[model samples]
Target: MSIVIIQGPHAHGLASGELQRNLQPLALAAGRTLEWFRCHELRDFVACVRSAKRRASEFMLLDPGELGLQAMAHPEAGLGDALDEVDTPYVEVHEDASTELGIQPGQHHAPVATVIINGDIGCSYRIGLGIALRQLDDEGIAVRAA
Candidate 1:
């Protein structure tokens, strides 16, 4: 199965390589083909997510960073709506807790399955991957070993 990770603008200077490294073992164990997208702009992030929808990714992990939060607070930005269009089950990973942000995943009709690993990027992706794998397994979908 294929999995896509979409990161937001603030991720640019962050330790994404470390996050990817942490995700590798879980991805391998689940036999998932993984792809990563670090979006520097909201439009780019929307486009990437739309593309993932077209490709039918088994699951997606999104760390929307600052851009996403900003978009969420501003309706005109439309990022939430764009994300809502994705059919794949997705977990929203946050670098801060929802309580800190006062926003929750799936708020305003977005289909976020869960929110995970607040304040910890690497652990978020790792745990998110495990959840995705388990969800697939529960559905009787075979995860190919990498």
Candidate 2:
């Protein structure tokens, strides 16, 4: 399955990069191949998701800060309202997640430990990624420079 990971700006330090790297472990453990697209801009995120949808049967958009949540939290913030434009489902990885997700402070670069995944997906690979993501979130880990 093709997964487009939307690393929102809220993802501080190297969280985005760390998230990208950690996907490998999830793929390895699941014995599945995952096509990941990392994006920061809203336009790029939308394009990547759209592109993935066209090519893959399953698609996922992961934003740790709850891209939609943040948007909805603010009525005047067009960002929250823009969530409606995304047709696909998404999973919001919270700032304070579980330790099993391998989150830690002052960590730059993806965590080598087991990945913590969370979110919605139909494929097994996506499931693994979700678990890994969760681990990362819980640990409060990041990929920024030490």
Candidate 3:
């Protein structure tokens, strides 16, 4: 299975590295391929999401960070719109509770299977990858052997 990770502005630099390190082992264990894209701005976020759509990833893990909340607050930002276009199952991760960003479960403007690990970034990716692996397995999708 192939999965793409889209990191929002807040996940730049060190945070991005940490997320990759934490997600890699789990992805390998699941026999899944992982790709990552980091967005430093709303435009970058939109473009990366568009690229993911083009790539047709089987699953997506997004940590939209502050940019996502900002986009939700302002439709003109178009980040939510970009996300809405993706048909792949997705998991949204947040380092803080959705309420802190004025969001709530089932209220995300995009279609996602679930949101995970509200206050814990490291654990979020681990759990997100597990969810993806399970869903893929349930669907009888074959994961490449590591």
| TM of each candidate vs. truth | 0.78, 0.44, 0.78
lDDT score, candidate 1, position 101: 25
Angstrom error at residue 38, model 3: 0.9
What's the distance in Å from true for residue 57, model 1?
Answer: 0.5
- Candidate 3 per-residue lDDT, tens place, 27-71, comes to 888788899987777778778876787897988887777676666
Which model, 1 or 2, shows the larger lDDT? 1
Backbone clash tally for model 1?
1
Per-candidate RMSD, Å: 4.3, 13.9, 4.3
Give one digit per residue, the lDDT tens place, for model 1 in 1-146: 78899888564377888777877677887778778999877678778877887888988887777766665566566655666677677777766654122335557434344555566666666767777777877666444542
Off by over 4 Å in 1: 98-113, 116-118, 141-146
Local distance difference test, each candidate: 0.70, 0.42, 0.70
Q: What tens-digit string does per-residue lDDT give for candidate 2 at 1-146? A: 33445444444444455555657666556444456555555555445545544554233545433343443344354333233344444443434333122223233122223223333212323444565545434444454433
lDDT of 2: 0.42
